[model samples]
Target: MLLLINVLLASWFYTAHGQGKPCDYPVIKHGWLYYSYRGYFPAHVNQQFVYSCDRYFVPPSQRSWDHLTCTAQGWSPEEPCLRQCIFNYLENGHNPHREEKYLQGETVRVRCYEGYSLQNDQNTMTCTESGWSPPPRCTLVKTCSKSEIRIENGFLSESAFTYPLNKQTEYKCKPGYVTADGKTSGLITCLQDGWSAQPVCIKSCDRPVFEKARVKSDDTWFRLNDRLDYECLDGYETREGRTTDSIVCGQDGWSNKAACYERECSIPQMDTYLNAYPRKDTFKVGDVLKFSCSQGRIMVGADSVQCYHFGWSPKLPTCKVGKVKACAPPPQLLNGKGKEIHKEEYAHNEVVEYVCNPRFLMKGSHKIQCVDGRWTALPVCIEEERTCGNIPDLDHGDIKPSVPPYHHGDSVEFSCREAFTMIGPRFITCISGEWTQPPQCIATDELKKCKGSTLFPPVGKPAHMIEYDHNTNKSYRCRGKSEHKHSICINGEWDPKVDCKEEAQIQTCPPPPQIPNAQDMTTTVKYQDGGKNINSM
Candidate 1:
């Protein structure tokens, strides 16, 4: 009974002094306690002690020893000591941070030794709680070193020293050389081992040497299959009866000879009643022939005609027997006014011009002339209306549903079909009653597909493993509810999300009954607590 009373007294003393129960002795790895409690099995509450690390080791705080206190949950800092890391013996690299050992939270710098380099070109490392951050590793250099590249008859398009893997550069040839692909310039790529191809310029066709001709292109060199267009000089024409001709560069030399012969006009045909001076079988360009009426006839039109590259100019005169008369007046035109107003009479071969009013477009010739005392046909003016009628169809694309008479400032969106990729703007706008440049849909192997989210189920099927092609649409409903939604796959991305959500329960009722044989019926309803209540019908 006395021993029981003593235990009860000890519990009461602990509660009164705000002291917690004693804790079991801790066993630390690679460390020991600084103060030895004389033959004590357990530590008392609120007892303080200092712990220390062993050789080549340190506490988590990087100190030789750390303080700990007993608490209700046990000793503070359950694990206090950690092993120290040593920096040495790095292959193909040298450790710049000279230290015997390192504790947690310590950092250092390392560099590659001569004839070696870092794997990613990084040089810094840190000593984390576990070990070195980004463990030090050095490897042999396999990168392509920068150097001056020289081409015999070509030059680099851009000036740069560094060339990463798979990078490309262009080189253009000088005047008399061409690339292997029959082009003036060529591209080369930096491969994993070395450059993909060397820059080279090969001999091509020599400079053009021809008389009575001027080449269209200014390039002095021409590659195989290259065409050169040339035009004949004055008084010269190609053998094909044309003023211009083209020659292709073949493997041996130019395919055709660049030769042009002197031009000659055919003999002129004369009228039976007219006499022409300087009669000849053939005439040269720029030659002129004079005409005179025969006997008592009069001459109309020009008296002489000159030979030009495009046949005769003006026209040969004609012999007539009657006198030229004056015209009464020019006929009026619709939606247009003539420059010659209040003119009662017009002479033969006289001309008058007409112009349409605002918002009108003139059709046919805008001038009228009196020929042989008769006016030519008059031009017509049509109204100018600016408005788009119908949306043009796309080659491999489709547009969102839209209605037209599309006016200014309206826009429409487009999407490519399956297995096709859009190349330009997705949305086109109407400006000044005309649609902007529409995008092109080019066929491609990399077609975009969209996977439906679990929150939305495609119509008539589960969403799992369901893939939608570009520009396609699908409908869904909120789990078990009546509300429906839709989504479209545009450019591999889904837009205007249709998500399923938990719906709040709502109460409703049928329509109120009507009185039999009633003359007039009126219905009144009120809502309370999310339910409809009918008062009268």
Candidate 2:
């Protein structure tokens, strides 16, 4: 019987193996050996083998398996069996029934549809023997939040609205109105299907109204809308408001035509002066008048007077009686030609005499008297003529006599003695019988004029390089770039060399080329740096 059983077993093993089928078997050899349809097994069934067999097994009676048997079953293992199955499938290019399998602590990725983003985790959980836990789910993400809208002095249809992600709000201003900040087309932010903040609508001003200068002249007056128009009375002009028919009325008051009146003053007249005559028909506030005395008469007070609000400026000045008087008497006298006496006062016709010591001579008159309450003449004392006649002449000198003998009223002049130049006065006068000090002369060589050199060259278009005289002005121009240049002397100082090619040449150019509107050209270049660097280009 054992022999017959061995033959049958052997035949069955060969047949099953040839069919590429999998099966399970009972333990063998008194628990020391075991066998399956295709292979030998141990007493204890290996869980891994059992899983594999279960995945590919068919009912034992339904035999007739072929090389494609495993694929035809469409059976795939779970967990441990699937891991090996997957390996087999990869190695042999076989298709497995199990779509996917995750081990413990493993994750599977998940994705959302178009137009949507995952709000929850986008990955899956692993399957344990306890069964697959719920996989991570994906949710759409929202980009915008609800927002509020506000209008100045008004209300909004809705204060808030939920906006989809990446969306915006369009704004419009009310009729008869404009935007204060943003225009009618304004926008608000939408974050995660919500708005960041409320959008605002602001109020604006209307057409401006002009106020006459009398009403808005003061700076304090201004329109509520931050705009104002200004106008002035007839005969006045506007100084500011131009466009927009409005002005900002600065601290200096209304800018446009401001009211004002013409200023005027009444004419003035003159007052009289003491002891003076008027030279004109009338006088004004500042007129000046003069005063004087008749010939043989003298003035005693101010000679001029002015007209003022309070009549003449310094009160009318006066002119009084006049006379010529002699100086007070000297200390001493000699020869006693006449007795000396002191008088309280002298009348019109009073006479007095004077004399000098023996060797000295005097100048001026010897006797004087009063006439018309004034001194008739000046009196002086002197020595006799005999003393002056005896004076001797020095070497290199000569004694020249007067054409008319020297008398009390006569004067004489003297010149240098030959080569010797006299060093004192050259004229002398006779007074009271004696001649005054002799005259002196000076050398002629000391009277010549000074000689100096001219600073500028006399030829070659004499460019007054510079002149010491402050009043002299000069301009220079070169013929060409090689030598000619344009230059000017400012306040007696010459400018550094300038290129002539860029400037007008002297005589060769017709009066500086008749610069058309030169002044306007100056204005154009005034703020410009000038084309000095043109050559670099």
> For this target, which candidate reaches the highest lDDT against the unseen true structure?
1
Residues 209-231 of candidate 1 have per-residue lDDT tens digits of 87688875777777767888888
- The Cα RMSD in angstroms, rounded to one decimal, for candidate 2 relative to the true structure is 30.8
Instruction: Extract clashing residue pairs from model 1.
Output: none
Question: Mind giving the per-residue lDDT tens digits that candidate 2 earns over 1-537?
Answer: 765576567557646666433333432211111123433321121222231123333222222221111221222221222111111122112223456544434444444443343334223334433333442333455655333445553333334454546666655555433344535445666675356556554444333334334434344324234445444433223333222234443333334433332211122232222334555555654455656565545443234555543334332323345664433433234543534647656543355555554444544334444434444333234444542343234344455675654555455556665445554455665655566776434343332222111323345443433233322333343443243333443232334333333544331100001123322111001011221101000
Looking at candidate 1, the ten consecutive residues that score lowest on lDDT are 519-528
Query: Model 1: runs farther than 4 Å from truth?
Result: 1-24, 27-29, 34-46, 71-79, 86-91, 94-102, 118-122, 128-137, 145-192, 195-225, 228-244, 247-297, 300-309, 313-315, 318-537
Cα-based TM-score, every candidate: 0.39, 0.22
